[model samples]
Target: MNPLFRFICACLFTLMVLAVAAPGQAQGDGWPVSIGSPAPDFRLPTLAGQSKSLSQYRGKIVLVNFWASWCPYCRDEMPSMDRLLKSFPKGDLVILAVNVEKRIPEKYRKAPVSFDFLSDASGQVQQRYGANRLPDTFIIDRKGVIRERVTGGIEWDAARVVSYLKSL
Candidate 1:
């Protein structure tokens, strides 16, 4: 092969490998709760200006979502989240939405979000969840164990998922 063609082929092959490997790359600090490890506690301020601790909600199901206002998927999932919470009898499930400050938009600045919106501005909580994607969610059982996790955005209010949520 010609020298230039060989070099170009090498570059193309390298790009291909990187492209395939990119899916495993860390999108955030890689904070998705793993099995057998305690979920890290965080004290994040709610949109209402009150602070909350995950540990404080022991014995209740928690749906923790790492999201950003700019994420179209996050935007799409918000209404369902709102509806899911409203459909519940309150205290059965709680949402801990942490806006990764770097990419979040300003429009999401309000309080008493149908559920709860927390901030991971410093990425402390983000780092804890091994969150590699936006709208990543973990369904914590009432006993505080992470039961299920969605690395990509999820339609949590789907009939099946909602039923599962209700069952939890």
Candidate 2:
């Protein structure tokens, strides 16, 4: 094998290893909060003008979703999320959709969803949660410990996902 080819292969292998290992070890800025970490508490204004805090939902299973209206994936997964919220009885699960965009889109303000939509216009709460990516979701258990961190869009209302959450 050529010397240059060997060097390239070694570098590629190193990069692949780092990519696989990074998320499990990532902390602080620019990374999603690791699973099992305490969900970061924040109080943000709602579209209705009232403010809500994560600590207030400590006794309930909280689904903290970081999303933007401009992201198609975010929009696609929203209905599933709404269904997920509705599947549980009131107070069983608390879904807080934190909008990271500077302006809350008009459509969302009018959408009929029981869960609260919060405004993180300054992105302080988003950064604190390390939700640098759109459509990041953290499932915080009743005791306020983060149980799962899901990046990208998913079928949140799927039976398997809902069942897993119910078991939590």
Candidate 3:
């Protein structure tokens, strides 16, 4: 390769890599998605052989949870999520319960449960929602703005979160 051409190619490659890594450069804390940024869209398969998309749940308040069966906190939070889903006063609240456990096809499919159970065996969905910790919850308001993000375990039906959802 010619020297000038090689230099140009090197610069271009460096710029591309920098662009891909730019999102992380300024962020030093825990939250992955910014408060005002549009919630990242994802399409993953549900345990019941259905596909779930974040974009499809627009026009409603969405509670996006990242959890695993092995995590005790995650296990504890399931009931709250279920209750929240069933008992929420209005039809505008939706829960997208995502499981980050390994894809155990039969067990996931056969398990009888309430609420939508989607898979993120590769953890891509989890990372997108800033669910680095088990049982992380993100509340995306009706306007598709990510309003709140709670790390670790949380009561999805808690009054504070509920009030915010209601306001949306």
Candidate 4:
């Protein structure tokens, strides 16, 4: 066995082991909410002038979405979010759409909003969740552990997404 060949083989084996041991590791880098992390608790006002807290949804799957009314991505994804909310049973899942603005826009206050439209006027709750991007979303499991974190906009009602939520 040549010395150089043995060294190269050993390095390749080590790299393969590391890669298999740490699948999906890059998904958590720089993300405020990571899979397996406890979802941060927050209390914020709802569009109807009522205050709501994350703890209230314990033992159920919760989707915490941080968005601003003016964000185009947020606007685009909202309809899909509504559909996602409707897909679940009344108490099986809770979707908290936290508005990161001073006032809940009239458009959002009007008809067809199914989820809990929370008002994070001071951005405190958003900051607590580390939601740096508009339309950031965290899916928490029944145990209140964040199972998934998605940045930017995505179709929340997509079949695959719905299936994943159901599995949790």
Per TM-score, the best of the predicted structures is 2
Deviation from truth (RMSD, Å), model 2: 4.1
TM-score of 2: 0.81
Residue 48 in candidate 3 has what lDDT? Answer: 67
Off by over 4 Å in 2: 1-32
**What's each prediction's TM-score?**
0.75, 0.81, 0.74, 0.78
Q: For model 1, give the 10-residue run with minimal summed lDDT.
A: 24-33
**What number of backbone clashes does candidate 4 have, counting pairs of residues 3 or more apart or in separate chains?**
0
**Top candidate by lDDT:** 2
Task: Give the C-alpha miss distance for residue 39 in model 4, angstroms.
Answer: 1.0
Local distance difference test, per candidate?
0.78, 0.89, 0.78, 0.85
Candidate 1 runs further than 4 Å off? 1-32, 102-104
lDDT tens readout by residue for model 4, 1-168: 999999999999999997886655453343345578888787888878899999999999998998888899988998898888888988898989888888876887874868888888897777767798889999999999999889999998999999999999
| 110 Cα displacement, candidate 1 (Å) | 3.3
Quantify how close model 3 is to the true structure by its C-alpha RMSD in Å.
7.4
| lDDT of residue 36 for candidate 3 | 69
Prediction 1 global C-alpha lDDT? 0.78
